[model samples]
Target: MRAIAPQPLLDLANVSKMFGGVSALSDVSIRIPEGRIVGVIGPNGAGKTTLFNVVTGAFRASSGAVTFADEPITHWPSYRIARAGIARTFQNIRLFASMTVFEHLLVAQPHQGAGIRRFLPARRADPEAWRRAEEALAFFGLAAYRDRIAASLPYGIQRKVEMARALTARPRLLLLDEPVAGMNHDEAAELRTLLRQLQDRGLTILSIEHDMAFVMTLCEMLYVLDFGVLIAEGSPAEIRSNPVVIDAYLGSEA
Candidate 1:
């Protein structure tokens, strides 16, 4: 008897994106297995961010399909896609400067109900939302910073606050864009630990990062893109040795 293949948590089949005459992605395909960390790496203008935008519904693909949890989400609006359990952080920190860390988390919580109930002012604090927010703060080691203004924290701590906010959405899959972009070595190491903790908690992640060391160590598998095309996909070790990747992205580092 043949074994059945496990369905991917997210799958992109022959996806293509174009901005007028210029192609940002062409025939790109990838599968993110459930509960795994997958990395996408490329040089500047390699279309990594374009792929993310297409998947998250920020831009509809010019052609091909995007499916999440076995459902086709090709034409869904950005808000609908987010509501369907996909959450992401931007390449740049997107925290509300004036808001407290705790407040940021609170605002990210998905509200229950619809119509009048949704629009009506809450008469009381939402216990569930508060509980989730507190848990996220503690999990990310930001409990003490809960009342601190987001802009006043250190850069590393601000990144954690942004991640904590994403977590409050209770997503099954997390998308991170340059998550450790501005961190020092120690901060990056701390973030690596936090990412593993999140993975262990059953959250699957798809990340696009320029930090080669971080991604190579954290990701189970990787996809390499160049000029809107997927040139390779494999384990970190395999990718590190691929001559095409070395030439296009890694350069002398390889």
Candidate 2:
């Protein structure tokens, strides 16, 4: 018998997003198979973040559809999409100013049927939330910084905290934007290992990254976008040599 292919955890079918007269994503279609690490690469203004926004329901698509876990979620609200087991970290680290690493994880636990109250910090989180938060803390090796204010930590540490917080939500699909943006060589390498570990745990990840070295080595496959359009996609070896990709985005980097 022929081997079966994995189902996509997230699928974007000819999705497009428009703002007034400008188009941010133009008929972009991509599929993230279950338990894989996929990366999207493009230069600045390539609409990478816009893609994330549309998928996460920060912005509704002008046309086309998005499916997650076999459910149509193109029109779902941001919170609803999140509650449905999709979580994300921003390109810019968004950590609470006065909250510790552990506190950040506690507050990030997904809660349903709680609207505005969810935004308010909990005086005492439930035992399950504490367990998840603690697991994330240990997974990311952040136990030492658990009591330190998240924002007071170094930039790389803060990035880890953001990821840890996202994980505490217990997402099936995780979207990471510029995950290694400000990290040093060692920090990025360590993150690469951690991400692989997450994938081993059956998490599907879609990330937008400019760090070519990091993306090339870490992702199972890559998609290249230019001016809101997907230009190319393949294994790292294929992308590195594609003329269109090199000319359009990778340039000297490839």
Candidate 3:
């Protein structure tokens, strides 16, 4: 008999959430492998973002389990989850409008010193964090714009800065919600290449996106959600071919 491979880097087991009488997710389960980009796609109000929130601990699930690195972390707080090696971006860009691009990266740097004492910056300390921040700026091709105010940049650049801030966390699992939501085709393609580079550096990305073509190039696998249930799961080609997925998402195309 052949042996099965190891478990996924992240797993959701029978997970669910509800608001009043409405269930956002119902008994959903998914497994994400290491070093692979997974894309989530669905129509509006399909519980895509709700699933991300549940995994990142922005909200507690009404039932079921979420596991990272094989350890359960369903109810942990958002900050705790971040420290636990999970980091995420918003469906809408959320950045400190008044802060400079450099400051944004600095703030997301990991806390090196211990406790409250760490809050106060020493006259001289940890050059490592600063190095990482600068490296992040260059990684996103924003080293030239590092001094600019974040909000002052164009929308496309703001998106790049938002992603750079998330990278500053150096997360094991990067969750992106519509990172290319509002962009011209050229800009979106550029962002896709950046994400591919990040994944090549060993970032595990789980993204929610509407641009089917964009997702086709980025994701190694795809999961479809509709009315809070997982309707399909497969490679990009398989997802494109699945009739039910087409029916649920592309009505006439199905």
Candidate 2 lDDT by residue in tens digits, 1-254: 63486558899999999989999889999999999999999999889999999999999999999999989999999989998999999998988998999999988876666566544556443667878888889988999998999999988789889988888898999999999888889988988888888899999999999999999999989999999999999999999999999999788555
lDDT sort, best first:
2, 1, 3
Pairs with backbone N, CA or C atoms under 3 Å apart (clashes), candidate 2 = none
lDDT of 2 at 186: 92
Among the numbered candidates, top lDDT falls to 2
Per residue, candidate 1 scores C-alpha lDDT tens digits across 153-212 of 987788888888888888999999998898889888987887898899999999999999
Model 2 C-alpha lDDT versus the unseen true structure = 0.90
List lDDT for all candidates, in order: 0.89, 0.90, 0.87
Candidate 2 or 1, higher lDDT:
2
Clashes of 3: 0
Decide which is better by TM-score, 2 or 3. 3
- Tens digit of per-residue lDDT, candidate 3, span 1-254: 63498878899999999999999999999999989999999888899999999999988999999999877889888877887788888888898988999889888875744556454562134467778888888888898898899989988888888888988978999999987888889888888888888898998999999888888888989999999999999999998988898889956433
Q: State the number of backbone clashes in model 2.
A: 0
